[model samples]
Target chain A: DMKVTQMPRYLIKRMGENVLLECGQDMSHETMYWYRQDPGLGLQLIYISYDVDSNSEGDIPKGYRVSRKKREHFSLILDSAKTNQTSVYFCASSSHGESSYEQYFGPGTRLTVL
Target chain B: QQQVRQSPQSLTVWEGETAILNCSYENSAFDYFPWYQQFPGEGPALLISILSVSDKKEDGRFTIFFNKREKKLSLHIADSQPGDSATYFCAASEGMGYKLTFGTGTSLLVDP
Candidate 1:
């Protein structure tokens, strides 16, 4: 079965605290992405990693960073948590040489910053 | 910059009715368009997609009608069910799906 998993489905942190969001996929997809969804802004891409240690910034990468040390795992980190940063985070993966660039998404993580 | 845009921010339709969701993009470079569905407290899932080469693509009851010249597309969900009630997002990418930009989304409600 193809699946993507995320740790800490729910998280709470205080202001100025560091936050980590981890994602793992079973399909060994070559590309992984991090995104955050807001009420009116929609799904905003934070980062995209093509492979291990190869990453690119998305539309909203100002307060976030991503790391991909393995083909199956990707992580999103925030140096300082702010109330404005609180939102649901999603991790997605896609493979090249496929019929199309269809992205498979993980459940997601809800983060709250106080 | 909100390159992609969705209209009718919210829509309500009776079960078995057809629900139409519209989307438009600002960039001519975007050749791929995909529609994603998101339920409450869940992640968005790829519902259907279309390439610039195709004007229409269908999967079961979901269909995408694209007009490349106008840079517009619409998703038509036939016989929508209550289970189909969710937020629908329209996304675009310049090359494949490596990087995507999504629209605000349209909240759909199917009344059974």
Candidate 2:
């Protein structure tokens, strides 16, 4: 079975601190995505990596940056964490080719900024 | 415009009852629709999906109803159990290699 692993199930950071959320997938999927889930706001895409070193901004990319140094790993960085940035973050991977495909997601990381 | 829209932000039902979750899309180019289910503290998982060419698809108790003309679809959970309590999200995509637009999600609570 394909599995996506995320580091630090829970995190608490101070305002202006740098935060890094790590994700690794065993499926070797070509597409990876980062999303934030907020109450009543739903899941908003933050970034997407099509391949190694290839990153694309999503609708909500402000205050966030992403890196995919390797095909199996993707990282989300918060250069300066703020209170408004606290939310549950999810990492998803898909093996979609020419046809649309389903994405497998990680357990998620809940981050709190104070 | 919100590409995907879901109704009944929250719903509660007794065990064995059928729960219907509705979803609609504005983009006519959307050819693939997928329903995702998420439990508390976990990420959403692909529960079921259907294509534009198909009107309905079923997997056990979960069924998808599609209306091409209306550009709407629905998820019907038959014989819902307490374990079914979770949030369901509906997503749509136009074609391959594209990002999916997701609905706000509907919370379903199945009481025993």
**Top-TM-score candidate index:** 1
Per-residue alpha-carbon lDDT of candidate 1 for residues B12-75, written as tens digits (9 for 90 to 100):
9999999999999999999999999999877888999999999999999999999999999999
Runs in model 1 deviating more than 4 A are: none
lDDT of 1: 0.93
- Which DockQ-derived CAPRI band holds candidate 2? medium
- Regions more than 4 Å wrong, model 2: A97-100
| Model 1: CAPRI class | high
DockQ of each: 0.80, 0.76
- Chain B TM-score of candidate number 2: 0.97
Candidate 2: Cα lDDT at B31: 88
